[model samples]
Target chain A: MFLALVSGNPWLESLARLAIIAVLVPVTVIILTWVERKVIGRLQMRLGPMRVGPYGTLQGVADTIKLLTKEDVRPQTADRWVFELAPFVIVVPVFMAVVAIPFTADLFIQNLTLGVFYFVAVSGLSIVGFVMAGWGSDNKYALLGGVRAAAQLISYEIPLVMAIVAVAMLSQSLNLAVIVGAQEDTPNIAFQSLAFLIFAIAGLAELYRQPFDIPVAESEVVGGPFVEYSGIRWSMFQLGEFVNLVLISILGSLIFLGGWQWPWSVFDESVPVVAQIAMMAVKTAAFILFFMWMRASLPRLRIDQMMSFCWQLLLPFALLQIIINGLVLVYDWPNEILIPLSGAGAAGAVYLTYRAARATGVRYQPGYQTVGSVL
Target chain B: MTYEEVIFYVVAVPTVVGAIGVVTARNVVHSALFLILSLLSVAGIFILLSAEFLAIVQVLIYGGAVTILVLFAMMLTRVRDMPAALDGPQRPFAALAAGAFMVVSIFSMVSTEWPGDTNKINVISIQQIGNDLFTTWAVPFEVASLVLMVALLGAIVLARGEEGE
Candidate 1:
């Protein structure tokens, strides 16, 4: 239908695709905002927004209206161009990642051969936006938050990329559609559970959600790099973040949960397009819900602990998974062997976390401490 | 001009402007941001050439990691106090060195016997690159990794400082 409307003009086709994405993303963000509020409210045993629309369905719309009408404030001391451009810098890369992401095998704006790599590469560019917002604000809290964000992001990016690399290795392809197709019989999660765990944890850090949201820790930095933003500008930042949450969930589903592919290949034939999309949506929703649950339940980690977790525990295990994968692939070991090996690695990771927590005595104590003592 | 040529100019103009901005921007943070713009535009050029792997790496490392490191360092230090840091007594020497380097690079670029047609995009697969890196270029790959490992350790040591201190 889209191709028919656009005829054969490549430029028009591209523009139409982008136009659809532009509309789809904001609507998704609005729905997600409402869903997050309600989910978190349920987790906290409180009623969320109940006054906007039926079951508060229109709360996001109301908030959007408010934000759009609110004054766009910029501090007199703020750098004009940097302050203005920071939101676009942060938001555009996320939407760019969406272009390469496949919903169903055939559903994507553009399916690049290096889809995973392109997503990772483009997403990393947002760190610059964080720093820009922080510095441009000329506020100390914003500056601190921005720097913390950059540090946390770049640090965790390693484990995240390594986990993705492990999956790419398992699938022996970087293309998203091909990766999903490779998991037609067994999802990569079956053998690469450890990588999935790393991906989830690192993804949590990447999104700066709870337990890893030290950059924007409300009690500390007070919204971090976005402290100075207001009105529509602030909405743009929130839009980017929620959109990123959706993107990460989608990517996770595609790579690990056998996106658009039924479990056990029950059909033994091509699944209908609708069923495939439903499968993708269900998996992505599961990830999004899991993230929301974590946000509600988990306490934010200290900066030191967060950094150490990524570097010490997550990074090593990620590398170990890759190495084990290499050994199995090179030696042509039976695929079943990976189940036990990865399971053991996951167990080791859990045990190490338990030991680390016990050694640090992280219960009910909050104060600055040496990194070595915590580690 | 062809569509590819049009896109090339669109990207290349920013690349050149960004390079100039990096040197001319009075504020250091602005300079760093301009450096990112320049790096990103170069990545765009790489995409045009169909070296998608190199382009992604360029964006990932240079545009993302390296510049963020610079920005992080800037935030940690007194960046505002050094507005005129780029201007100093060594200007003449710096200019001479930059000029000489530019001439050498341009000469090398023009003289090189390039492979393949200028108009066609040759797409290379990541698997082939990985295979060649591990097989034919194994030593160089290992050496590169060794150098990176050494640098990583050196950074840790420098950051840690004297143990007792």
Candidate 2:
């Protein structure tokens, strides 16, 4: 149906594809918002959104309507142009990043040869939007949140990109389909588990989800960069975030979980598009659920702690994974060799994190007796 | 005009306007935002030229990291406290230096006889670039990285000095 309609005109075809994404993304965000509330509620031992549609399925819809109708407010002191444009800066890049993401082998808006690189680069553009929102709002809290968001996002991006590079090296391709196809026999996860770990951690930080969500910590900077946003403007920020959540999940599944190929590859040539999509959905869903679960279970980290963790722990481990992969590829070693080496790195990361967590309690420094005494 | 020409103008207009805005904007943050605009549009030009890798790198480093660093400094230093921040007594000398630099760059750019097809976009694959970097240009690549490492260390030292003092 789509192919026939979009036949002949590249312009029309792109418009049609974009339209589908534009419509589909919001619907997904709505469903996800409801799911997140329900999941988090379950984790906390309570009913979530029970008053809306069946089991609160319509809660997201209700919230959407509310957000759309809410009056957009602008503070008099705010930088008018910057404040107005900030949300777009934050939102548009995320939607653009969605363009190259493949659901099935064939289903994508545009599959660039540089799909992984394009996604990372485009997503990085959103950091400027956070800063814009922070500075434009003219609110101290908003400014602080914006700064935190920028720092956290920028720092975590290194590890995330490094992890993705490791996978790209193993696959010897940057195309999403090529990467997934390369994993037909054994998923990249088996060889690059350490990269997977780094990707997950860095992905969580990128999403500004819990534990790493110091930028938007309610107790501190009170909603971070979006503190001043309301109505449809604010909804745009929320949309960017959930879309980002889906993007990261899909990318993670594609790079590390073997995308649509893994368990279903047994059928190989006979696997239907529906089946392929279903497999992709399952992995993406698992990632989304894991993100939500982490949000519910973990305490938010202090900004200092989060930054230190990314730089001191995650960055080093990610680089090590890349180095190890390079060695294996250069030496023409068996792919199986990656397992033990990557596993050792993964173990080392976990142990270091464990030690760091244990050692982070309040301790007295020698020269700071007065400050230490209070603690 | 061709589609490529159309696309080039679309991006090129913003690149020029953004460059102008960076120097002319009253607010320092506005200048940084304009700088991002300029950088991003240049990335768009890279896409027009079919250098997707270089385009993305431009967006990632210039549009993303460098501009954010500038904003961070502006915010941390409380740039708003000073009125007419850019209107310093050194403005004349700065403008003269900038004008001279721009003239030299444009002269060099115009004078150079560029190689490659003028009509067809030369598509360079990532693999080709990687092979060249590791094989033909390996020493220069390593030297560039070494320079960056030294700069990184220097930044750390500068940042660390306040505590020591």
Candidate 3:
């Protein structure tokens, strides 16, 4: 169906898609920025951006205009071309990743057989932009931030991909649409809850939201990689981050929340495509709110702790989920049996982690035993 | 020009230019960036050939992982963003050998008659590759992974050194 439309003029069709993506991503980023600020503000007992257009809806627009009007600055020691190129590099892959995301049954830009792989691979490319921004800035703070960002991204990516691999295993397909289809009988969260949890947590770290946001800790490195960026360039990085937040939320919804499918098979086939799209948007919005809630509530983690969490805890759980999934698939276990077994496995893993943490005195700190005190 | 040829040149030009830039760039960071561009354009070529899986893997492994690791190592060594001359004493001999290899490769390419499949290219899906890797080539695949594991252990031991180990 899509091939027929593009067969008339492939270049024109591609151009149209590119234009839509270029406009859509920035617009989504704008609204998402406002949404985050408002949600986070309310969480902290404040009215967020109330003075701008009705209920601060136009705040993102105003901010964009203001950023556009502001003077762009570059450090004297900064790498000229790379510093300028970094923001576009950051933004483009995010839009590229969106190409494989099935917005609705027929609403996606493109649906490759390797949709999940494409999204994961393209999303990983954005770290280069952060690194470039950091290194190009030529400031020690920015450089440190860039290195930290790269390190954190590389570390968290393993668990993120592993969780996605689990989903692929359950669905038996890498295509997002097919994954959604497989959930018609039941959402993946019913059985792959462990994988869902790991994906969400790793995704949060990948996005560098609070707790995992050591790279951009304002008190520490001062905006991390984008410290030296000013005006439009800085805004681009901000927009890219917001876009990423939306993308991760959408992915979580599509992979675990059954996408546009109605839960329990209620009106699963009878529902109109528009309403299905709306359902996807609503599910994605729930995740966005959850992300904001996490940001408001969680304290920043030490970099070492963050690294250990990904490698030690998340990696093992993700690997275990995969093994359980492999066993279920190989043994041809019924869902009734497999779901509870996997759930028990997940609970056991959590309990063991808690016990290990307690043994190490990490969960509850011991009373002060002075050994090489400043005194 | 035919569409495929046009697309080929479009991707190939940058790839060649990037390769040249990687060799000639003064800054090590710039060289690394050029290498990324070269790899990405190669990925683009893969896409043009309808090998989407391979293209993404190229982007993931080479463009994303290897280039970033190279840049990371360069930064840790405190050489990044510095204006260091890349010219070495072996430049002339290296160029001579490289030029000879290029000539030989071009001669071989022109001499060879490539087997052409006139049929429509069927995209080999990721599932097929995964199946073949685990079933048909399982032993080789496991061996490759074991090699990687050994290399990883070696790096860790080397980094830890005498007292730490």
Q: What is the per-residue lDDT of model 3 for residues A223-289, given as tens digits with 9 covering 90 to 100? A: 8998998898899888889889999999999999999988766673577888898999899999989
Model 3 per-residue lDDT tens digits across residues B1-165: 888989999999999999999988888898899999999999999998889888999999997788999988887777853565466698899999999999999999999999876658788877788899999999999999999999999987786565343
TM-score per candidate: 0.95, 0.96, 0.92
Candidate 2 off by > 4 Å: A1-5, A262-264, A360-362, A366-375, B114-117
* Deviation of model 1 at A366, angstroms: 18
TM-score of chain A of 2: 0.96
**Model 2 lDDT per residue over B50-156, tens place:** 88899999998998899999999898877877757769799899989999999999999999998856767668889999999999999999999999999999997
lDDT-based ranking: 1, 2, 3
In model 2, the Cα lDDT at residue A126 comes to: 93
lDDT of each: 0.92, 0.91, 0.87
Between candidates 1 and 3, name the one with more favorable lDDT.
1
Give model 1's share of reference contacts.
0.86
Docking class of 1: medium
Stretches off by above 4 angstroms in model 1 are: A1-7, A266-268, A360-370, A373-375, B110-121, B162-165
Model 2 chain A weakest lDDT span, ten residues long:
A366-375
**After superposition on all CA atoms, what RMSD does each candidate show versus the true structure?**
2.5, 2.6, 4.1
- Candidate with more favorable, higher TM-score: 2 or 3: 2
DockQ of predicted model 3: 0.45
